[model samples]
Target chain A: MTVAIIHTGCANIFSVETALDRLGVPHILAEQPAEASGADRLILPGVGAARPAMEKLQSAGWDAALVAETRPLLGICLGMQLLFETSEEGGVECLGLLPGHVMAMAAFDGGRLPHMGWNRLHFEIADDPMLAGIDEGDHVYFVHGYAVPVTNHTVASSAHDMRFSAMVRRGSVMGCQFHPERSGKTGARILNNFLEFGA
Target chain B: MLAKRIIPCLDVRDGRVVKGVRFRNHEDVGDIVALAARYAGEGADELVFYDISASPDSRTVEPEWVKRVARAIDIPFCVAGGIRSTDDARTRLFAGADKISVNSPALADPDLINRLADEFGRQCIVVGIDSREIGGEWRVHSNTGDPGKTRTETRATLEWIEEAIERGAGEIVLNCMDQDGVREGYDIKQLTAARAVCRVPLIASGGAGAMAHFEEVFRQADVDGALAASVFHKQVIGIGELKAWLAQQSIEVRP
Candidate 1:
């Protein structure tokens, strides 16, 4: 199967590219929207503030392409936040593929910001194809200052100072707040599931 | 709950893994890629590679090794040393490094931290402080504590930690020069003081001799992670065995 990774130019995509390579999956870095349109799967990976990221997507024509995309698409880290309606990081409007607002993580009671480390994932959906073979309470590496809250679209939820959506799925579009490429074995399993989503 | 991280630091000099005793008397370890893969397989939470010899005049840690390690291991890894500018950090990050750590350079130009944090986001910017206790006060040391290289800064350990966080540092890796490579245990007394002012994830480096030492640092200082080099490189403590032992001690670790 072929995978197209949308290069937003806002963050590094090397780890994600290497992850796909390890899976023995053939993928291409789609710098333009047309290249991504022809792929079997698409992935939007980013890491930075929201306003500038949206501006890059808009200028590169990915914003419109992603909005019209119907195939299985995945967003990682800041890319996941971009799938939401709005973000508090830069107070910028996003792709709005999912129904939620991205807010800064609350550091209540001296909780650390950025929530950097390995945290356990609690699955909210039963037998999700995206989470196949991954057991509940499995730890995944997370590095972010803002996250989406738990909602009906959340497939798995993890907490820092408050519960947030670790994995969100709505039809063919999905997003992960954590970097699956950097989360090790469990992360590899999740990526494999996404690659084999519809056989 | 966020599981406490167990990081295996690889001190690389001229592309070979080396461990030094108190910032002196270096001993070669092994290949960077092989060791990185081994640690990741053994369930290490993360990996750190510091190019000990990287300087502004010399080439930064080659992107070739970073790419190899990223291809070899599935876990996250950070690269340190000689990252003097955003361009240097960008090269490593684009070459597959998940994070870029800065030390001496950040001290020379404190604004470098702000620039890095602004361009690459604070999550990927880590400020490493090499500290030494002198006259009963924890002092921040520059040039990796090598007496031949440079001298210590006047800024107190806590003062630097506070400034780093204020300037947008996402994490702090406090390396206690007095305890580094000693293997007696982590410098809890110093780490505890740094932890009070550090709002970001704090990692304790230096003086990890036994498995109990890991537990002590985690429990007493409540730091987010513990980093050691020789102990794991010399096979004094296996990552798997240590994680299992930590789990048995009621400390949360990724299985």
Candidate 2:
């Protein structure tokens, strides 16, 4: 199966690229969503600012192409953030595919912001293909400042500053707050799962 | 809740793994593939290869070696050394490096940082800074072009760091050359200065003696990750133990 890493010229694209490389899954570095349709699954990787990301997507004509597809789309950090209706990171509105809002991660008791490190996942669905082989309490690597709340669209949530959406999958579209590429073997399992699920 | 990170630093020369204190390793410690597998199995967050070849002539070896090493480790592997342009970064990324590290070129031409960020994206471009304290002030130092090329004094640490981030270096690697083999601890002051304006993750390198040093860097610097050579090489601390120690310190680590 082929998976396309939807590229909008954001940072961390190579990390995603490397993750796919390790998995040995053929993937296209799709500059636009049209190239994405060639693959069974699509990955939206987040690495840079939301404002510029949206601008690049618009400029690349990815918006229309993305909307036209019904295939599985997995979103990484900023990739997940952009799936929401809007994000506070940038005033720019997002894809509005998922019915949720992106807000800053709640303040930790006394810790600094930008919740960085590995944490466990509590799934909304008992058996999720995307979460295959990942034990219920297994820790997944995360590096994000803002978060997507546990709205109706949130499929999984984890406790941090406040309980927040850690994973979100909705009708062929998926997202993870963590960088699966950087998360090691467990993360690879997740990426592999995505690949197996027709990526 | 955020996830913890585990990293393994690999010193590669002529496609072989070597380890030593002060850039010296006794023998071929182990196969890069085997060690990479061990790190991946042990739940490493990422892997980094610092190419320390005597001459900069055979630069393509690292990326080629990365393709081979990439097969062994499932974790993200970053490549350092002789990476100065977007083309070089592209080659490495295509060859299987998760991130490409840039140093001299970033400082020599301020715009190269942003240009690279715009071209390859910011997070893929890691600006590796080798610094040393002179007169109680940290300064950026460039690796001599070759073994014969002399190390040149560059701009102040913080000043160049500001430009790096401004130009879109997604991450900063503070490689303290003086403390590289000293094994005392990282330069917390230098890390703090970079952290003040560093929007991306800060990886603290150089000067790690024991697990306490890891704790020191994590606690004092509040860095996203800590990287060291001698400690990991000499088996002072295993990846799991280091993560456990950080966990004991109440730092959320991957279990």
Best by lDDT: 1
Measured by TM-score, how close is model 1 to the native structure?
0.98
Interface RMSD, Å, model 2: 4.3
Position B14, candidate 2: lDDT: 67
Q: What TM-score does the predicted chain A of each candidate obtain versus native chain A?
A: 0.96, 0.92
Error of 2 at A195 (Å): 5.8
Cα lDDT of model 2 by residue, A1-199, tens digit? 7878887676567667767877777878998666666688888987657888888888988777777768888899889888888988757799988988888664334444445556788877757788888878777766566787787767668877587888887878888887787676778888787776643
The lDDT per prediction is 0.90, 0.74
Candidate 1 chain B minimal-lDDT segment of 10 residues? B143-152
Comparing chain B with the reference, what is the TM-score for each candidate? 0.97, 0.90
